[model samples]
Target: MATEITTAPHDGSTDPASPARLCGRLLGRVETRLHDFLAAERELRTRVDARAAAPIDALTALIDSGGKRIRPAFCVAGYLAAGGDPASEDIVAAASALEMLHTCALIHDDVIDASPRRRGLPTVHARHSAEHARNGWEGEPRRYGESVAILAGDLALIYADQMMSEASPSLGAAWAELRSELIIGQFMDVVVAAEFSADVALSRWIAVVKSGRYTIHRPLLIGATLAGRPELEGAFEAYGDALGEAFQLRDDLMDAFGDSDATGKPVGLDIEQHKMTLLMGLAMDRDRRTREFVLGAERDPAEVRRLLDETGVRMDVEAHIDRLVEKGRAAIDAAPLDERWQRELGAMAHQVAYRNS
Candidate 1:
């Protein structure tokens, strides 16, 4: 998922090596690498298969769109925390690759969501679908659009793998694991939604495997592996697991009630899609209204939202998020990171949980 961070100047010195400067500064490298790589790839695709440049353009445009750079930042943070050279080509390439993989996921996700808008603009599929319509294509606009988007996502995954291939072999295993988890998570998500399964354990497992492991935990491990710091593995997982849970919990909340402009997604999507979440699982166990509301949300979302409000699951979820964030904080406190990363990651945790998008 993409995020938008709000920055404030640090109180201390304006030293070049300060943690205060690292967060947004490292993102500059990521953006530059992404731009340069995509430009080269665009030229290469144009020469080899000119028509293929369209999807590449879509991917590049999406990257150019605004983002908080959370995943790449986490990779950099882990590398720095492990004393890896941030200026080294390996780390920069790996970090950029993480963002590419994220792009791939979002493309596929937008296809799954059939979402029209992302980051306040047309999603890759929607953009292509509109183009198909404008061209007076001879087939269904949506099918043509979605098929192109799948190819774009596949191409993105290929580019991500190509970018990270330059990194150390140790990083390769984590990369494979991450891709596998992503596929499995998507599969599980579909099953849960299709069946409307309220099994609490299944819901939690989906959260852990999908968002928790894929987003935060593996990235942390990937960073540490790049630095050759195997000792930090347990600590990385601990910190990542909690933060990842908080991240998804917040995502679900945003899907339920956030402004379309603020979230870059339609409000009440979870209800509209009937996606299973832990909050839904808990609410189901407590009363019948939650189930009724979820079932009715597709037809009359406002009433379902009202029913949801009366059920009080929203407040319960808020408290649960607080608890998970605290666990993440405690893990960070006990981790073998330096003072600089300790402060940086602590601040990052709050950003992950409390972010508006």
Candidate 2:
């Protein structure tokens, strides 16, 4: 949900108008805006005096630990590029809703994946699991842990829906479609991991649903919709596809080579969890040895790396990542974006490709 991006702290080497600069500037703006939004939500919670505030305690931690608010910033950027008002409460609401939706997805995703960490801290499940054990107030410890996390994720989704509803019912139908695609994507990821659909076509479908629509297309579509730029919707959709693919490529790269401390999750998690990412698919698709290695793999990272090395799987996957980067840049180039947004988009493409997290 955080649409994880990897970037180093400011080194003062890049110009302010550079893509890195734009990304940093935009991220700063998002952080500031998110704080305001969370404060408002907290104020609302105080008035409601409901159990919903329980999740609010860790909410800021989770949000603040996020890699970057790339999706929400893109939504706002796209909206503005399409001649939309950045000051529109509805537009801001829509961007905020997307962020919430992404958070909900990540909460559920971490639970489903049984991930122990995120953004360099204990994942929600891990936090709750530890708490459950410390309190020693229940049945099976794992069950308690999973149950609390499930409830937390559910709460996030509920709050996200509430936020979306406040964004204007005009976005309801589109939001529903986006939500459905996300579910379908998650399901496909699970099924593929179980060896249900190990084909290349199926992997592509998963890419479209998981990364394409969820992160790229849907967010941009919502932005354009709010901007009322109906004519250029197709262009935005195309841009989203490329950007989303680029985003996923980076995800695959980070999964393999990222800093566990930075990503807030363990490295080699995809291999450990057996999630069917496009990188894994490319590895398998390349040769018979790669297929055997991946399929018969254990949870051992060294073994996985060895297999990847022997079959050139890692190299092949890395090559595909480069290709995706080029494709994303080309798509952005083709898109009808304003100069400012175009520069930002190009810079993001670089970050997506080269990110170490």
Candidate 3:
């Protein structure tokens, strides 16, 4: 018999059939599956050559460091809500794959953004660069570190594909679409940041495609697909899209006003990079000084934050988040899922929209 995985800590609810309880159990399985898979891969590479395992070590370290695990949570919630079997290992594999892909994105994104930290630790590229510098290793330290980070990210992407391959063949199309969309969305984000056009429409499109759909919508759809419940697609899409925008907006707010200690990453990165965030776009549209701050050559994140608050853009965005949370709840309420799942999903929407990190 297989060893049973433990669920997340409960709220004193002894009922095992509770939707939250079941989803927590599934998420636990996903966590275990990820650890086991990476451990085995590390062991396999170590036997061949100790140095060969360095990238695996980096991948393992990042996974262990800590993340929100939002994608996997949404995936599991979608599966359970769609009535997937609690015992099915397929969902576990799929959820694990989603997390691996997210890990891959993070590694690569840090390189692109030149972010020095993640989860309160030196980012993969930053750490490796320092290692290269300290050791006086080959070529440019930055180049060497970036190269290693890229390779590690590639390894993660490959591992994600391998894990997803264990799932049913029916998921091939959706999986392909998800992967491609992530790449395309990232590409668009990079391009828009370089342009810094202050186009609200463009910014909104990037937000929806890069953060909203990628973070929430696709994961939910993948879960529904894995549960063999294609009928839930429409409702899930609506919920995911609305909640996803709210999620991204909250992220923007956190970057602007949240504590670095709590977020485990540098705040105001969006402003520093001059990336046309949805919040920034709204601020520019609503206030002249905010627009001047963004368009000016000497942009200061602190000044932009002050401008946002002064112009009431922050309050407006908060109101928008509330509306989106409600919209997400209504979508699930109209779905054919059981009331328990609807409530659980609604709770999730609120959590995502209001998260501080």
Q: Which candidate gets the maximum TM-score versus the true structure?
A: 3
- Residue-by-residue lDDT tens digits, candidate 1, 229-284: 96787887888888888888888778877888887768787777777876677777
lDDT of 2 by residue, 78-186 (tens): 6666777545766666767777777778878888888888777887778877887898866776777677667767766776787678767777877899999999889
- Tell me how far the alpha carbon of residue 1 in candidate 3 is from the true structure, in angstroms, after superposition: 31
TM-score of 3: 0.96
The 10 consecutive residues of candidate 1 with the worst lDDT sum are 3-12
Candidate 3 minimal-lDDT segment of 10 residues? 1-10
lDDT of 3 by residue, 233-337 (tens): 899889888888898889999989999998888998989999888899889999988898789889988888888998899999999999999999999999999
Worst 10 residues of 2 by lDDT: 4-13
In angstroms, how far off is 127's CA in candidate 2?
A: 1.0
Task: For model 1, state the Cα shift of residue 82 in Å.
Answer: 1.3
Q: Rank the candidates by lDDT, best first.
A: 3, 1, 2
In Å, residue 19's CA in model 1 sits off its true spot by 1.9
lDDT of each: 0.80, 0.70, 0.86
